[model samples]
Target chain A: MSGAGVRFDGEAPAAGEEPQSTATLAAVAEAAGVSASTVSKVLNGRSDVSPATRARVQDLLREHGYRRRGGGARQSPLLDLVFHELGSAWAMEVIRGVENVAREERLGVVLSESAGRLTPGQTWVEDVLARRPAGVILVLSDLSADQRAQFTGRGIPFVVLDPAGDLAEDVPSIGATNWQGGLAATRHLVGLGHRRIAVVGGPPTMMCSRARIDGYRAALGVAGLPVDPGLIREGDFHHEAGYAAGRELLALSDRPTAVFTGNDLQALGLYEAARELGLRIPEDLSVVGFDDLPVARWIGPPLTTVRQPLTEMAEAAARLVLDLGRGNAPVTRRVELATSLVTRSSTAPPPGS
Target chain B: MSGAGVRFDGEAPAAGEEPQSTATLAAVAEAAGVSASTVSKVLNGRSDVSPATRARVQDLLREHGYRRRGGGARQSPLLDLVFHELGSAWAMEVIRGVENVAREERLGVVLSESAGRLTPGQTWVEDVLARRPAGVILVLSDLSADQRAQFTGRGIPFVVLDPAGDLAEDVPSIGATNWQGGLAATRHLVGLGHRRIAVVGGPPTMMCSRARIDGYRAALGVAGLPVDPGLIREGDFHHEAGYAAGRELLALSDRPTAVFTGNDLQALGLYEAARELGLRIPEDLSVVGFDDLPVARWIGPPLTTVRQPLTEMAEAAARLVLDLGRGNAPVTRRVELATSLVTRSSTAPPPGS
Candidate 1:
């Protein structure tokens, strides 16, 4: 007898015989006396399936061995959330956002850190595919062509959160308006009567970082000010990079009166740099930061910053991935939440202006 | 023919028939020409199983339908990590520590925030059980007796991180030496000649918070000073509570020369209170905080605080749970890592000393 049809009859199977292939969806549908589309809907966890119909389809699917291709036997109820690292309050905000949605849906979340690496290793994909989660949400990371194909082949759905690089046209992604955040931060400084403003931003090649810098340039252009390459410093969106860049700008003979950083960590570093030189905030230098992390409000002089809705973006990504997992297409391929300027105590008219 | 013994023969099955219970481990082992213990070891993912034997056993187990009890069909490779909240840098530190260990073990982590609630809802347990994670790690939270019994019944392991309440004698947990941290913080202020010291601590019902307050009282007793009831206040270990408590202590007829807070967020809040009252740190009022989170170093004048190794605690909890999940009993029911005093810019002798 072929091994595929062997059932549990309280009798032992022959030694060394293995099931060759899983049964087809069509066969499972026929056995359940339901249309193939209904079976497909049930498999995708669509809400339209009645409870009785869903139960029947599930039992038939189990009996006929209709598992996802290469995904062992059953799909896990958890969703995989992958991050490049988990060291900052920024990550905590994103995590909270995802947890909010996950709680509502009663789905568990699996978190993976890529160990400060931009891209997840090949083994990461292999492990995820093996777990066969209901969906995936990747933050500031991307998948290789091969990895994408593997997930697609297995019918797994994934959504990107603030992707660090360009994504395919069809890939659903959630992010904030980095360009608007940068523009607002720069404009706030410029509005404070600062003529010589400097910008310290993240890695030059990172999409979000580039967009912020572009926005800074656009703001300066709109104000009829010439863009000075000397005032634009590239940082790694970290405190050390911000400190080093701040020190460089401060040491210059013609230092700018105002500075805008790509993120809050860098802005704090700039504050240290300014402190070391006995420069008073607002009186000596006006500073603006992005991300508006919690510490921004608690600093000596609260930081004026552009608030990126990281939590909301994370929630959107989670919701979108869940929708896609349930066989529903996204309403839009790319979602950009709004960014707003929070005026705290860090910014003022330039010194002696 | 009996439905259980039907052969594949590329034919559809008759309707309305269901498969029986999955094959037992004994049957799987017999088919694979191995001992039952060998198959059990493979199922538990123990390191003792040889690759060749494991592969053969896995194939046989698949053929016989040997799935984990109540785990649908497969056990997910993820570990559930639940927290009280994810709004603070402290939480981030813990997450980083867990990620470090999880990465080394080649396991995925699932994060959940209980939204500042002490206990997870009923659905939380149901969802976790449904996912069938290898293990679970809960931070500053506890499971109900029923929840614990459910996990135990399903053969899933769980470890508590910095549990707020007393645990069962046999439950595994990881925490810091809160009493020592408190003593060190209080002793530092005492050594600086601050006799009139005040304490702002977390909820009295929390074990760690109570330990810290006791340590504070211990340090005062060691110095032959009376523990003034007026100088001790209960807080929620949050910024707002600190600010309010600081204002109360500062407004006292006989104000304290120094104040020690339960956590860094409260310390920052005290800083604001001091600022509003035109008090200069160290010069006018000395402050000490606990849990030297990253913000403690970046804040103005930095903060003198007790350093609780949250990351290490999380790592230990991860390791302990992984061991438990593999059927290994913990070497100890409770693990307490060391805490140390990190002196920075925020503490000094009383102004008149």
Candidate 2:
């Protein structure tokens, strides 16, 4: 408690400037009133340190911008790929992408799930520090500022894949052009004379989903069609959510002729809803989906979707983290890969056109 | 080559007996004409050793049945889960299963794909050796006898999940009752008054497919129906294969009224083929699938299939391997979980009945 506000010998760099005076381990230890070995143990993620002491030391380390130099040779030949949750073919594609890079680099991939949380647990960060992987790639997951400082202090680089929420501008992230994909999907349906098109957006909390809905609204505006609030449904990105939302929308007196489910899994749910309502695809109801997961092509009538290139995005994230680990700064910290419209049998002209 | 057949100072254990008098590392090194440090390097998967020397040293270690004692402290907190090919909802189920066990045990999961190969590559084995995971869980994949010997020499334990091919009797494995599942599937179709039933089995090389087909045959035999050779289609367990087989089977002059697709993906393919032919599910034709993947419930008509309990099976495999690593020999090295029939809207009485 006495060391809480003590000024350290090190200073943090100015915004947008490279760190010029990273304090050594001994300086941080002296300022925190601990032995250098204690600071070393904390950096190594040893569990022997008490939570109170660990937090105090971590705060001092961050305040001093203390980064260990030349720890690359000591790093384990591994990369951590953390996910918010592990379900669906979407994850499988991402896993394959990371596996590709891991194989090429001869590094083992450590797979962990945050168990549906937006960020990994404290224990996960501890385990990661102990193993000391070359880098980390997070999919739809973020870290608390303290957790971020912990990794930064250890010289461990991380890249976010498809960030679920707003991130600091300094954090490197890879994403698809979700807004553009949404616009293209809506424009395609509009071109097919579907004036009353419905949009089933994923969880509004997710930035990707929000961007997509914004694009949907933009497309309608560009096409000179008034955006109908009644036709927009907010649903979680899952099959059940899509099913419930679909059932409600289809049961309306004036239902839309086409529906744009935010993702492919939700689109499948919508498919079931349409099936139960005796609606034949493209005949009575047209549908579009995003992600273009492999199942998108296998389902009956095949889904018309925006190809998000999930695997490529994952590969890019893996590469970026590795590059950062090797001290190779990227030209840009934020990147959005191209998303293309894939036309299939699920979309058609409005009935009796 | 002079070290090829030279007998070392170690005696292999008798069949069905525990190993006795395990040779020392120094003895193996001397027998292989290498220094003890070189032999230790080989054990640690260090790449400095020449390939020839590495193979020679490994052979000597296996001949001696050498086991490193008290290396648990040095082992990384990891469990390796290798897949023959990372695809589909099937792999996802298995990954989730292993993750559950790993999370509880406070172990990190290292995932690898063999890229469609029945066995993982040599490089993968070397990396696994270097990482020294607590245990290994292999999915639909096998290892060469030499590879197995190497792991055994290092006191590493592994378990197979859903064995794709024949395995040695002593090899521990976890699987579902594929034969019984097939029998139940066919019996359900028969009970629905489908006398002319077609069977679309997975690859003949996979023991699961063979067992399932055999069960189908047994069910038909018990029902006093002759096994129609022309109605059995040998296809791989994939959507495209199902589509091709479905096209062929449906094109028969006297097409079968119902089909038992070996897996869910193939069933989806069959659905596409049926839709193309203007046949409605459960009315014009009946369908059955296996594995009971999440998509099975989401697809149109909600596929009637066999629930293989893949996640449970994977959990069992992971637990078994961990138990083995702790020298807790299981009562049996082979375990098969039960598979049950999940009846849905995909089956019905004959249209003319």
Candidate 3:
């Protein structure tokens, strides 16, 4: 049973169990009542079989458990990276870029994810290592500190995507310039001459959120504006949290005229809150967000946010991983990309006096 | 030098290789001039490190070539699995789900990809067994028939997704009930009173295309409409192909009032073509597409498409791979999932009469 991310611990085929052929092509064709050519195509990965015939042949093969050769002989790749929660395919965008570099280096990535809450954690790393995968990429965000260390301590070559902490250098790390992006967003709002500016972001402890806060502070300092910490609030980096933050800010006596959010998903929540409060965009409040994900364009008025090249980031990380597999030494490189604020209909000068 | 996706071959360690001490918590703490708890917290993947300190520690460790484990253990997971043309984390959708299943079943996947047409027929399969991955996923489409057969025949326990032809029973296969899905799409158009219907499909030789064409024919038969060969056309399942098909169909004297495309990517192409030709969606000509991907909803006039639960389908495929890995009989299970027809602004009773 070969699964996408499953790893086997047995030896490659010892000096023994070298040659085993279970069924002949002629036999499978005869049993399935198909011609040799038809069987040959089906067996070859050729797509010329009728659905009925395909189904019948597949049935026969499955029932008889007929394997032409009893042993495998292909040389497997050096690394496999399986990510979890890649549902929307957004996660894949990065891996795509990463795979290109990995291929050149002869590293293989078995892309797969862990189940809900039953994360691949320790067991996953151990199993993958046994297969002798040179390194691993955890498309992760919420791993506890201990688990990360355990994997690192186990001597597994691994990197975490959007990790919750700054792991050791032996483990390469790549992420967006959240702080710069935050500053860009705040500057965009401040440029509109808004005095009462509010900031909504994810939990304060998250590095991303902290970086955004730093950017917000920098933008304020550059603007000669006094930073009122009271205007800053934290959410869960989710739409609902954004909505709550939006509502709270809007209800304040000295309500903020402009707001900067940490992520697009959070920006969406603000949009909903505005609608709920009977407030129109731009006319009532100017908003900006970060991580211009694909859906950013679909939200009402098309969000004006800072962009993060997620694919590039993923690719860069993948390249680093592949380089590690190739026995190339990587420096402790922390790249902070430039962030640009995309202006859209969602932001405009604060409405009348 | 270890990186993501590296594999350990259990080869004998080189002579005179001295055992090295893993960076202990105390050492890292002393090296960084921080408290043991602080280093411990950082190493354990906890959240409390100040940005400055964290970055400093991480950088220092990398500069020193820190290895978390002393050299006794064998190097872990060196095997890699290369997929074909799966750009972005988009392909990871399958990988993640597959990984989850594989992890549970104690397997590891090494992800990789092929360039242009550089795959070495079935020779790669031989290489895979030699490297000793318990199983493989072929990714099905990227490999040739010979390669697929080589891997499968060798009992590598591969579960082929979107198999071109039929296989015997013991080999696992997973894909959508494409024929039924196609039928549903055609029926929707017919019920909408579209008589002069057209078809835009991928390579007709592909099973998915054939199933949809069959469904379209079935709907026409039920509607008592004769199939016009000229109104039907084949495509390469690309945007360009769909655009060409749409252009050709629209030029016909008896233009199709509605068209059903085989794939979402192609459907998007058809949409672009219709717009270029100034043919309004439902207002000018009805266009329905298959594979209701996320992009469908963002179009100016949201596309009317057949929604294939791609994520769910991926999950199912992943599960099948894991099940097979667990020594479950290789079952020829054809999970026929029902596709839903999503109606939006794109489809309407074809332009007047």
In order, what DockQ does each candidate have? 0.23, 0.32, 0.13
Answer with 2 or 3, whichever has the higher DockQ: 2
- Which CAPRI level is candidate 3? incorrect
Candidate 3 lDDT over residue span B112-164, tens digit each? 55553334333344345445445555453445544443343333445556544
Better of 2 and 3 by lDDT: 2
Q: What is the interface RMSD of each candidate, in Å?
A: 12.8, 13.2, 9.6
User: What does candidate 2's lDDT look like per residue over A213-269, in tens digits?
Assistant: 999999999999999999999988999988998999999999999999899999999
lDDT score at residue A155, model 2, on the 0-100 scale: 76
Q: Ranking under lDDT, best-scoring first?
A: 2, 1, 3
Q: Tell me how large the interface RMSD of candidate 1 is.
A: 12.8
lDDT of 1 by residue, B181-209 (tens): 89999999999999999999999878999
Q: Report, for candidate 3, the interface RMSD.
A: 9.6
Q: Who is ahead in DockQ, 1 or 3?
A: 1
Give a tens-digit lDDT track for model 1, residues A285-350: 999999988889888789999999999999999888877766666678689999999999999998
Which CAPRI quality tier does the interface of model 1 achieve?
acceptable
Record all residue pairs in model 2 with backbone atoms less than 3 Å apart, i.e. clashing.
none
Best by TM-score: 2
Best by DockQ: 2
